[model samples]
Target: MKAVASDSAIVLVVDDSPESLGMLNIALNNAGLMVLVALNGAQALSIIERITPDVVLLDGIMPEMDGFDTCRAIKQKLPNIPVIFMTGLTDSEYVIKGFEVGGVDYVTKPIVPDEVLARIRVHTQNAKLTQSAQAALDYAGQYVFCVSNDGALEWATPHVHELVDSLNGDAPCAWEQIQQLLAPWLAQGDQSQPLELTNFEPPLQAYFAGEHGSNHLLVRLVTPKKTKTAEALQQELPLTKREAQVLYWVSFGKTNWEVAQILDMSPRTVNKHLEQVFKKMGVDNRTAAAAISIRILESDEEAVG
Candidate 1:
């Protein structure tokens, strides 16, 4: 196999031990890979927020936020980035736990430089191939995207913006909305089934895509021939046409300012409509309004079906 270009790939190594970090850093740097080192999981997360690495070398045991927790956090953000665990314990339970927490592969303690490099190469190459395929899909305007268990958009096709806008009434699909929708499933832990939200304008569906770098849930924004019109919602829900429109956007977690821009109204006007929606729905908060709006939309779908 061809070696990756030193400048092409970045690797993050997180370990509490100075010796392990130093050794892995030198080995990876020598293998023509850019290396970033963190003394602990917190430091690793801070660095990851700024830079996306191709692969992560994580120490399984540390004083705080151990390897499993670190890997979980990483998967939440970068669901496609490969994580390899480095641990001294080789018990089956420990290994299983590693995989459970999103480790792609593991390297035993007293690491062999050559073995580590080989494993990194394999995972990194695989990641590149998957990303290349995803890029092709994106260019072809495919709606497939990978979201983390936390509902964070890890990667999506460029065409996704249009679907998101359609779902959110011309507003970009915000992370907060996605996370709110996924909160229920994520709370169920490992038994969480594939989640689907068909309450939007275009109606979206999500399935648990196979775990690769992380446990990524594949979300597909379904585009139907005809979407639920605001008039249809007004008749079913106790809301006026304008209030219904506001509810539609609210369902996708759109803010009053964003709804205002979408509806070509002032922010104050949007707020007034939302307040009316609250009164009509007997909901005090936006979250309740969104939840009620989703149930109404889902019921409408069932009726039509």
Candidate 2:
């Protein structure tokens, strides 16, 4: 094949075989793509950290840091780049292990140059699409991001980067820590509530918008919302902490039973608290009590503003 040059793709091939590297390099270069060769996993990682490729062609088995471990490391740092494994091991276990370590696709050895090229093209196109989408989302000003099912951030906006940096000041692997925090919420899958993560001041709220695709989740960052406390409610109304707790949920239109479920008290206990709250606030029923809470909330908002 003749080497063709054009404004095109870059592929990183990580393998310990001279023959494989030499053959693949010629094929990829001739096809108008730039190929970076890594003798082992460590070199591949070093190359990747310096210049992220459009797609990664990884070998499954190597000495010391294997393909799976290298892929895991690469994914931890930059999850957006697609990883395609070129492996001699065709066992189901090996294939599954590749997927678990974040391999998007695999080409079985003896390595077919045609097959490898085709797979690389497909993944590169998909990766470009994802990058474009991520760039658009960055300018959308909604602080949106996409993460893999396991909570590795595929792409995040500048706003998210700022937030993470601020929260994880001087902390090593802050990105990993943020991922760890989101893991449980992501584990909830589609049925996730807004995760409340607090600092010394207000809290960051992570809302699961939906899934980006079959393999990714979309998360939206809402500005830090100060949690309304039972103590705050107590101050707003001349009521006991328990009464404030009951009234807090009641203000949001919770019934006695629902309030009990939230506050972890019996319905009877919730009713008792509500009765006491009414007496203390000179209110006769739930409506009047709720009205007072609303007025207090409005006043608090006004004060904050």
Candidate 3:
């Protein structure tokens, strides 16, 4: 039995029998989780309404409101929380009803400690993953503004408008705004290539490119900033503002099409940006570009006092 963390997950264990409840508490506690016991559906509902648990271990057979009804009530209140049914009754009807009521899985009792632990781990891991992914998506959806190495302004995703009022102070620039903002950040030595800005926001770095034969060149931005000091302490890389936009998607492992979707640009436009990124980073391929960009971004973080 592993000792659960103090901040370990809170588990709701609902069973009518004290013997069953005791057995579950031992297993859950050994696995390093905090257990809340309920002998009946009404007690379980009261706990759930006040404070949600990470996972619910529900017994299918109970007096008054049974596990099926309990599971339904839990789901209605906290849809994201997972429920695992524990029951001596292994009938197909009961099992199916468990799922219909939003039970994630069913475990036949007498409960094996290993089986209980495994089920708990599975649901907890899933809950954690879902939470992390949602947080990442939410951050990505927010407006972000970056200053190019060359002191030009570049923008991406329409959401960014909220962060910086001006795309170009003189006028309202559209998607084609990349060309105007990043001219100064282009590499001087390599006319065709661009400078890579290794530091931007703590954890986020950028790379910029010069004017290609077309009206615009692709941009890339990468940030791993966890704190304000972390973002501020890193030394700035030479990337232009335009290249920073392209780099942002590259770091997220987005394909050209996905990047296009986020930026509301055509796939062709995204591909064009990639070409500029490859040239600017002096990497012949996307893999090399991604590797170098990550390295530069990670290594540039400053030690915070």
**Scored by CA lDDT, what does every candidate get?**
0.77, 0.79, 0.66
* Sort by lDDT, top down from the best: 2, 1, 3
Model 1 Cα lDDT, one tens digit per residue, 1-305: 12233445789999999998888888888878889899999999999888788899999999879989999999999888899999999998989999999899999999999999999889988987787566547544556666666767667666666556555664444445656876676557653454666666445555444442344556554433345656666887788888999889888889989989998999999899989988988889889988877776665342111
**Residues 1-305, candidate 2, lDDT per residue (tens digit)?**
11123247878899999999999999999998888899998898788777767789999999999999999999987798899998888899999999999999999999888988899889988987876586656546656777877888887766666666676463347667657878987787554567765541235677787755446677777754345666788887788888998888898899999999998889999998888988999989999998888666555431111
For 195-295, candidate 3 gives per-residue lDDT tens digits of: 33332222223354333212223344443344222122123433555556666667668898998898788988888877877776688987887776666
Candidate 3: worst-modelled 10 consecutive residues by lDDT:
227-236
| Candidate 2: residue pairs that collide | none
For each candidate, how many residue pairs have backbone atoms clashing (under 3 Å)? 1, 0, 28
Error of 3 at 85 (Å): 0.2
**For model 1, what is the alpha-carbon lDDT of residue 18?**
94
Model 1: runs farther than 4 Å from truth?
1-6, 141-305
